[model samples]
Target chain A: MPPLKSAATPVASVLAADARHTVTVVLNGTPRTGQAHPRLLLSDFLRHELGAHGTRVGCEHGVCGACTVRIDGVAQRACLTLAVQADGRRIDTVEGLSQSNQGPTEGRMTALQEAFRRHHALQCGFCTAGILMSLSDYLGRNPKPTEEELRDMLSGHLCRCTGYAGIVRAVMDVTGQAAACDTRSGEAAHV
Target chain B: MKPASFDYLRPATVADALAALAAGGDDARVIAGGQSLMPMLNMRLVQPRLLIDLSRLEELRTLKADSGWLSVGAAVTQAELLSRPTLRDEVPLLAAALPWVGHFQTRNRGTVCGSVAHADPSAEMPLCLVATGGAVVLRNAKRRRTVAAADFFVGPLTTVKAADEIVESVRFPLAAAGSGHAFREVSMRHGDFAITACAATVDGTQASLAVGGVADRPTLRSWPLVGGALLSDLDAALNAFAWDLGGDDDQHATARYRRDLVRRIGRTVLEEALSCRR
Candidate 1:
């Protein structure tokens, strides 16, 4: 049996369902705090309470990747996480991607964003943020990934537009595999 | 979909978690990674009155080898276990199956023991557990017990764990010399629930195959390696096991197709495991 600690601190604490608890997080390098009930999700907290509207919530049950966000440096589903659970964590959403180089009001875009624009990777743009966040984290870890590897990694996100061809092309271009980009040139502009 | 209202408890120690579960009784649910439970909670598939978060308990996060078994603690995430450099040489079946468990994003937050505790019929963790003859370590306020993976799962999304018992860790027996393992699954999408998942282990003259997604729980069948005309006998045995593990005709696939997968993929995994054996 594991021995009990001698500290006088309470072993357990419960946050009531109806009661609101103060939730704090480091949102995109800025410390932010909000009040939420136990049932409130992190996706809803980021959008409604913290004003980080870049993270979208599609299927709240964890199937869809629209709610992808970086928590403690890894991409995770915001909809699948509770607001109170992320109280002291560092969260990075799509808004943080572009804000790194310039302020949120600036017009500059990252190399991956530029590549996406050049390849027309997104049409409706609803799923672009989550996709970008996932790919950004993946490419940072796997800098020179093959097209097949990129496709496998993209399985985490869903995109109804562009058929994922242009997205794959854009990722390939960002990975310095531009020589193979022309193989899908005919499908790139159309997608 | 949104979860119903529930009181949240963050316990700093395993003792506190067990005490909370005992105090909350049948209404309390233990959450480690929340990868599986969050979906059920969001869809209101299970709405508990109290949820005890065990993420803060550092003692439940160890993943190391002890004697002849690889002991994986409850809070060790799937990605954390997968990232272990010695995993492939230590447990090849788990190495092959971990990538097929949901997506890379979910694995980053999904705990290995949590998946075993969830006991999803289509999940890879439980299938690997049953195939490798692993054990689940369960603890309550008073005592601790270890249940074999085969007996741990009672039905789909159901396990033998009592309401007050929390899974502490899971132990997978280390693969010995002259043994090989393989795992394969067929799903609609890359990261979707498998229609039929199979795992096989070839050790000496004995071989065992575990099939999932074709039954309420993962089922295992073993066969002895014979010298002459073994393929025919093995096919007949696999055919019978596939029929015995009858599946339901659902939106993803028909019962006939699932059995077909069992017959085909089961043989393929077994052969693959046999080919890799020393």
Candidate 2:
């Protein structure tokens, strides 16, 4: 039998005594890797370490959906996750959604953005990023959710100012006119 | 608040993880998704010297069905379980109970094994597993053993899992065709922790009930089927168990209030389960 390896590595010693660790993650269509502490929260790493501030943090306890991001193509809360946990994984923040200058190109946010603008979905703007990420993820799985399904899906998110009426309208408008949106480029973006 | 510093190790195998835990001694902790553990760490409730990451172990991420049982790996995330088509048909109770575990975001990283290992009395996974008579497989460097759900939980936030052992998987027996399972909980908010949770499963003449959150460990009661008259007996049994188990008072609800709620919820869940058979 092979000799048994030592399993007694102390996490405190590693974390407290400054043992450097590196993690690789694909963020926003680009492969990015960095060195970080094991205790580093993914939300903090994105906003402070990597300067990707589009992923906002609200009610870090996982109640509010303001810290939502896509991890491995599924919407996840960044604030509640450790950066090291996302190592070797694919992550997409709100910044990956669309480009202002891209002009409805592939994977662009033309229709959803237009719907939000048309329905006045956002107010205060603090909760927009998280809502957008969640909505985008939902629409990808269910392109045409009924009003009840949309309401249930949006239950995880909070929009204190808009009261969800505008957001629901925006989702319905975008989904109801999905064919027209599909004719344009970037409407087929999943995850 | 910043989490207290801790060493991180991503072990490629379960043996390595167990060795790391043994070596780190009491200061070493196993972390899967860090969804629950991270919050506890941030709150300064636990400060382990080492964090053994189990994410690298591919063996712990599988969901397999055998002849009589379906086994779910410890590191299998809630999102994975929710999406797995097998679980929907094999264990409908788990499927129904999972969405209430947290939210889509938390579920993305939270693992079923991690939740069960944490042994939060009010947690959905533990209650559902116990109700279904699930078995937990714990492995160490030298040996591995399986503990039944009835014997796994010893107290709140505590289990039979040894410090040097890692939870490998949980096995749930497949329900018979006429079987039915139901889970319900009452919480202050939609996504908050449950003040009281109940799960019941009925298969023909046999019935099993497991109640969590209102007790230190999941309280389970099983008996042969009887008609409406037996409900009062079950309610009495629950009321007596509630007082006997010391589930009456906590930050969420008073001891007296909890006892009342448990009796009410237990009867309701049992009645619901019985109705499905007829």
Candidate 3:
């Protein structure tokens, strides 16, 4: 084992602890600017500073997927990201999903969202925004994913209600796969 | 949970980052992907006086395979590594273990070297590193050094890394011809930390098994099959190794159950590796 060095050497200047930095990001197809303390998370920055409430914050840690959003077109946890880290980046939240390329129609829901409504994928709706953001990004890349792959992707999120069966059906329907639903029995169909 | 106030710096180059570390010493912390560190920060587990962000440093994003090793740079995310076309061929153990590191959402942001820097007991990255006989590159303002993965981790969430140093990259030995590797873990949830993880690498002459989440650090034991060993001897060696790991009863599993996993999953991975060998 190499000898562990102690922290005795001294060198240069550091930013003040209370200093706030100006962060600018292209959020939801618009340039948004805000001032944030270095300690502020991107989740809070989006919700409080930028007024993008579609990106919810849950489990301030990375466990719950409610804070998941698209950074540079890739889905990632906003809670795990710092506001300054997302400076000068493009961020797409659930609000932007409705505005995506859906044949030139404004405020039109994506196929995934329509399926979610048809299959009753959301209840209480606390985790819906994050799940929609993740799935919308995912189903775009992997348009036709196996049930196992979709389930593996869904494992990242935690939803108290719905038991994830409706979410599975919704995704299956959007991907052009036949999904059986038994609403009368209130039982989850085999995914 | 919210993180305590701290000064944040995004250095454009590694030199500036090292300078910031040298100045702040232990009070400054380097953050790459922040998958593990952010949770700690939000929970106030680690509140540094300064936070240095390395996401913008382009030089630290190298991921290349050469010289019989797949060298992953500090800024290489787990998703980036998994997306590498040659990852499965160059480093099969890592390719097998990367999916189990975190969920797809977190993996999109979690760096490969960041996991090694965190050095969690049940983390799949360190276990794969030790199992494949890899190395970790450490850099500071003044010097650079390489340490074997087996010697890099001393305990859970603890490594030989110094306060003024950063993990420059990690090098995983490429899979040799006629060699095969496999990884398996038993976690409470799909994206949760493993209760017990097993990784195995085998070739014509030697068979090695590494187990994590059951000890202070990932431990590896090898058996030589040059002339061929008896089945009973192999079983006895595995059983002894499982006991030696000293599984602790935790919220997720009992000590006995962990040991059982070590013995069972350990053998299952070894058998899978042996059968996959070309």
Report the TM-score of chain B alone for all candidates: 0.97, 0.93, 0.98
Q: In model 1, state the lDDT of residue A174.
A: 82
Q: What is the TM-score of each candidate against the true structure?
A: 0.94, 0.87, 0.94
Clashes of each: 0, 11, 0
Best by DockQ: 1
For model 1, residues B63-119, the per-residue Cα lDDT tens digits are 998798999999999989988999988888999999998898888888999999999
Candidate 2 chain B: worst 10 consecutive residues by lDDT? B226-235
User: B10-94, model 3: which lDDT tens digit per residue?
Assistant: 7767999999899998889999999999999999999999999887678899999889889999999999999898988898888
Worst 10 residues of 2 chain A by lDDT: A1-10
lDDT, residue B121, candidate 1: 94
> Relative to the true structure, how large is the alpha-carbon lDDT of every model?
0.87, 0.78, 0.88
lDDT of 1 by residue, A1-191 (tens): 12123122323579999999888788887878899999999999999998889899898877778899988778888988998888777888999887788656565788899889878888888889888888777787789888877887789888888889888888887888864344335243322
Name the regions of candidate 1 deviating beyond 4 angstroms.
A1-12, A102-107, A180-191, B227-232
lDDT of 2: 0.78
Candidate with better DockQ, 1 vs 3:
1
Cα distance off (Å), candidate 2, residue A36: 1.5
